[model samples]
Target: MKLVRYGAPGAERPGVLDAQGRVRDLSMLLAEMGPAQMSPRTLAALATIDVERLPLADAGVRLGCPLGGVGKIVCVGLNYRDHAQEAGMAVPAEPVLFMKAVTALSGPYDDVQIPPGAQKVDWEVELGIVIGTRLKHVKKEDALGHVAGYVLANDVSERAYQTERGGQWDKGKSYDSFAPVGPWLVTADEVGDPHALDLWLDVNGQRMQDGNTRDFIFDVPTVLSYISGFMTLEPGDLVLTGTPAGVGLGQKPQPRFLRAGDEMRLGAAGLGEQCLKCVQS
Candidate 1:
C-alpha cells in the first residue's frame, strides 16, 4: 500500500491512497507512520486495515513527508560512476558514507531554503531506503531483509561548505529544508526491483538530472550491509543510496547553482514526485 501523511506541515495526519487514488484518512488506525509503523510486523498489521471504509480526506488538504520520527539521514556520495566522473573523482571501491542532520527533513512540497552565506546550492535526485529493523554486521545477502520501504529524496547541497571548507560533507548537506523526502512511503513488497527504477530532477522547469538506479556502483543490499559493519542500523534510519548524473555541477563550462525563487521537482518510478521552491532564508 502507498502510505502517506496529509494536512498542514506540523499537523499532518496519517493517511493512505486508496485504489481510486484518493487520500483516505488512517489516523483512527495508526497514530502516524513513524518508527513503530515502519517495522515488518506493523506493516503486516496495517495491511489488514480496510482502506475502503476509511473516511476520505477533504479536497484541499496539503501533503506532508510520508513518515514521522525520522532518525539519521545517512547518504552515500558519488556512488554512481557517471556522477563521480562529472565531479572529477574516481569511483571508490566502497560506498562513501555521510550523514544529513534530521533537522533537514521537510515535507515533500515545502520550499527549500537557500541558507544565508551559501552560494553553490545544488540538487541531487536520489532513492531513499527506510530501515525497518535493527541490524548490525549483516551480510550483503541478508541486508535487504532489514529494509521496510523506499521513497524519493532530494539531497540538496551547498558545494562551498561541502568541499571548500576543511571539514566533513555534512556541513554543506545538513541545512534546514535540504532533505525533502516523500509524497508516499512505498512498501518493499510493492517495489519489486529497486535497482531498475528511473529517477529525474528539474530546476525551475528545466531538467537537470535524469538517470536510473541501475547506475549505482553500490547496490541497496551492499550499501546496507557495508554500513552495518561499522554502526548499528535502527528503525526509522534512512539511507540515501546516491544520486544519478546530470546534476547542475556536471554542466559544461560552468556549474549552475540553485538561487532564490528556483523551483525543483524530482521523483522515481512508482514512488511519486516532490515539488519544492527555493527561497532565500
Candidate 2:
C-alpha cells in the first residue's frame, strides 16, 4: 500500500492510495501516519480496510513527509563503491554512519532553503528505510522484520561545512528542509525485494545521477544490523541506505553545486518521484 500524508505543513491528514490510484483519506482510521500506524501489525490491519469506502482525498494535494515521529535521520556515507571511487575515497570496511537532524525533514515538493553562508549545496538520491519495530543489536537476518516500510529521500548537503569545517558532517546536513522525503511510504510487503530498484536524480531537468540499489556496497540487511549494534533503532526512526554515483561533487571538469532557483527531481523505482526547488534561505 502507498500510504500518504497530505495538506498544509502541521495539518497533514493520513491517507492511502487506493487500487484505482485515488487518494483515500485514512484519517478516520488512524490519527496520523506515525510510529503508531507504521508497525507491521498495524499496516497489516490497515491493508484490510476497504479503501473505496473511505472519503476521497485530493489527488493533487500537497504531500508531507509520509511518516511521523522520525526520531533521527541516520545516514550512511560513501556506502556505494562507485560513489566512493567518484569521491576519491576508499570503500569503507564497515558502514560509515552519521545523523541528520529531524528538523531537516520536509515535504517532497517543498522548496529547499539554501541556508545563508552555504555554497557547496548538493543533492543525493537515496533509498530510505523506515523502522517499525524497536531493535537492538540484531543480526542481519532479523533486521528486515523490524522495518515497516521504504521511502525515497534526498540527502541534501553542504560540502563546505561537511568537510572543510573543523566540526562534524552534521553541521552541513542538518539545515531545515535538507531532508526532503516521501511522495509515499511504500509498505515493506509491497516492496518485496528492496535492492532491486532504480533510483535517479535530475537538477534543472538535467540528469545528474542514475543508478540502481543492487550496486550498494552493503545491502539493506547488513546496514541496519550494523547500525543497531551501536544504538537502538526505534520505531519511526529513518535510515538512508546511501546514494549512488553521479553527485555534483563527483563531477569532473568542474564540480557543480546547487544555487538559488534550481529545481531537483528525483525518484526510486515504485516508491515515487520528488520535485523540490531551491531558494535563498
**Best candidate per TM-score, number?**
2
lDDT of 1 by residue, 1-281 (tens): 89989998888899999998889999888888899998899999878888899999998578888889887888999999999999999999989999999999898899999999788999999999999999899999998899999999999999999999988999999999999999889999999889999999988888888899998899999999999998998998999999988888888989999999999999899999999999999
Q: Candidate 1's error at 66, in angstroms?
A: 1.1
lDDT values, one for every candidate:
0.91, 0.93
Error of 2 at 12 (Å): 0.8
lDDT of 2 by residue, 156-183 (tens): 9999989999788898898999999999
Q: Candidate 2: which pairs clash? A: none
Tell me the spans in candidate 1 whose CA falls farther than 4 Å from its real position. none
Which pairs of residues collide in candidate 1?
none
TM-score of every model versus the real structure: 0.98, 0.98
Clashing residue pair totals per candidate (backbone < 3 A): 0, 0
Instruction: Determine the C-alpha RMSD for candidate 1 after optimal superposition of all C-alphas.
Output: 0.9
